[model samples]
Target: MSPDLSLIFVLGLRMAVAAAFVVSASIIAERSGPVIGALVATLPISAGPSYVFLALDHDAAFIAEGALASLPVNAATLFLALTYVLLAQRHGLLLSLVSALAVWFLLAAGLRALDLSLVGGLIANVVAFAICVPLMQRYGHVKMPLITRRWYDIPFRASLVAVLVAAVVTLSGRVGPAITGILALFPVVFTSLMLILHPRIGGPATAAVIANGGWGLMGFGVAIAVLHVAALRFGSAVGLSLALATCVGWNLALWWNGRRKVAVAK
Candidate 1:
């Protein structure tokens, strides 16, 4: 196939993967309640596929560096989530979402301009999430009933994710690798979740869900770092496998503990 055609084909495939994963996870989240939904959102469904494509287009070394960069980028996303969580309390969905995206863009840009390494990025993510989680819990306690259905909800969500994935892929090369990696990991899934759930379940519940997902992202940060090292030592396929395993294990443990605590509290 010609390079142009191949690029189109690959971009289509990436969009398909991203859309399907986000929609499926969103459906499950709606049925399963907020915490489980949050856990599902943290699975790297969108970012994982993007990383695969990056590795395919470039090589293991490129993927490794991107993954390393991805760790620090988590802080930016956490900031985004927190922004939404806080704003959603006193504002409408559109206002909260717009503010959150602006914050994400600024933080991502600033972080990309800095000279950060794996250890530094990891530390930044850890601190950001650690500080934000408690504040999120404090602010995100308002609750509401499950929302009425809308005919456009699923289609709107699927299309939004697809567009975001395409935009990130198209823009990745224009920016440097660090910024590319950060943009690639943009909170597409999280955005979809909040957009759908906020109107339906109300802002408080939606914010709580995103906050929970933000805490869960620590696992994702660690997994990306591991993927970087493992991909360098081994290869993309093996490295991704190990990284997914590590992330899944961490997520499951967190879910179990969270569930157990909920049960005990009840």
Candidate 2:
């Protein structure tokens, strides 16, 4: 293969493979119901694949800086989820998603104006979630109805994620670490959920999934914080493992507890 053709082939392969991974995770999320769905949604479906590609190109320190910037962006996503969950209860899909995206963009844009250190990012997340967690508990659960699957659903969603990931990979270099980090954590899964579910099952049902996702979102913040520390200490490879472990372990514990409660109720 010629060098240029090989580069094109590699890029195409990256897009296809990442898209497949995100689409598969999203399907599992839809099938899993609110609690587990949130768990699955909160996993690093898009971000994880993007990180793998980034790690291939960047050093450990670079990866660590990206993780540092991702901290507050994770909080912004939780706010986006909260905004969508609330608006979806009383609004159409357009209003709900547009409002949520607005919230996300505002937070991301604000990050550019501030000199946000690691501590500042952590504090921002803590304060935001402190207010939202209680609301999530009250409003996040609703009985989910069966979804009618469309032939285009998976393909459509796969394309969106692929495009988003490609943009992140292509742009991460030109953008500084703060912006790159924020872009990496974009809520592609949440956007897909609203697109697929709101029309099929209605707003309240779709909103429940976002609301339920709050805990996992918080866990994601913690995991990224750990990634920042671990990368600086142990290296990016080890940091990624530990960060993934933290998120996975947190969700697993929540899942086990949910099951234990159901068994007791039975």
Candidate 3:
């Protein structure tokens, strides 16, 4: 295939993969409970594919640095979730989303200016997520309301994910690898899910989902930190594989831990 054809093919593939995950997660959120839905949404479904393409386009070192960049940005994502939850209580959905996105931009800018190392980035993410989760938890644990599925829901979510993926990835290339990595975690899936749920279920229900998603992001943070270090020592593929394994393991541990806590409560 020609280079142009290959680029188009790759872009299509990326969009398709991202869209599938977003749609599937939203569906699961509709069918299952918030915790399960949040778990699936937090799995780096969007970011993972972008990172893979980053590796393919750039070198292992670039991807490694990008992975490090991704860690602190997880905090920005947490902030977005928190802001949305807080604002959604009093404001309309669109206004709340706008306010939250504004906060995200401000926070991301401030964070990018700090020039943190991998360890510092990891610490920042840990602190941010820790603070965000419990604060948002009050909005969680509500009973999920039963809502009829809209016929256009899946298509709309897929389209949103596709657009977000395309825009983020395209801009990442222009911005350089470090910023690219950070931009890669733009909360596409979380935003889509919340937007859909906020109107259908209510602000509180959507907030619950977003809060759990923020908690789940802790595992994602660990995975990216590991990938940054590992990719430098190992190759891209190996590092990514290990990182994914770590993410899955951490998420499973969180699930089991949550279950144990619930059992104790019972």
Candidate 4:
């Protein structure tokens, strides 16, 4: 796709939406409770920039490179953000800005030495880290009141689901852009559900389903996006649509569940 004004406009809009979601989630978290908000914020914080990159480019190599390059910065930002939040009690705006710039400088130097294009990498690095700081502080930590046992299993469970989806898609010979797109939905759905349900899976159930599910979903989404794009297919649009659906579905389910529980308790 040519870099045109319309494309730039769309990219801007996507960034805006992502920014808005992150901010809203963070605010909601700060209001509801600090720990929960921090944990909740991680979703948009970590995934938002990557999502933007995927939306902008359908190239597998490019996506992989971008993801790989961005991971360190993302991790650093999350850790720092969490630290700042714990220490500051409120959002650490100045610290976040400085940390972001520091990360960008380090990433830029590394990219330069490796002879990689810094254009997209710089943007991704800056934006991803900048957003992750507040998010980590607001909703990065997992504190599941209702699902305490399964709280720790969220990431693992999501990853497993994502892997299973990728495996099935691969074996079915239906691993095209469309199929990959469908597969990408699994993570989005899985994460959304986990965030909403925050269920408690005690005993072995915790290890088997809960942990694997979280990692599975994330892994599957990233894997399929990479593989599909590598095959020269553009599945991002479909994948994005599925992600939106997952988010919507998750919120609805949560609302319904909350109401039902309240009614039962009363």
lDDT of each: 0.82, 0.87, 0.83, 0.38
List, residue by residue over 47-128, the lDDT tens digit for candidate 1.
8877776667677877788787777788888889889999988888999999999998888778777868888888888888
The C-alpha stretches of model 1 lying farther than 4 A from their native spots are 1-6, 139-144, 171-176, 263-266
Worst 10 residues of 1 by lDDT: 139-148
Scored against the true structure, residue 71 in model 2 reaches a CA lDDT of 88
Which residue runs of candidate 3 sit more than 4 Å off their true CA positions? 168-173
- Where model 2 places Cα greater than 4 Å from the true spot, the runs are none
Q: Give lDDT for model 4.
A: 0.38
lDDT of 4 by residue, 1-266 (tens): 56797665664555454444544553354344323332343343325433444545445444343333433333233333333333333324344334434554454345434532334434444454455443432333333333322443434433444344334333323433332322222223223322333233222221122221222223223333333333334454554444444544444454466568889999
Find the candidate with the highest lDDT and give its number. Answer: 2
lDDT per residue (tens digit) for residues 37-148 in model 2: 8999898888888877888778889889999888888888878988898898899999999999999999877864685788888898898899777777777668888887
| Weakest 10 consecutive residues of candidate 4 by summed lDDT | 201-210
Worst 10 residues of 3 by lDDT: 164-173
Alpha-carbon deviation at 47 in model 4, angstroms = 4.2
Greater-lDDT candidate between 1 and 2: 2
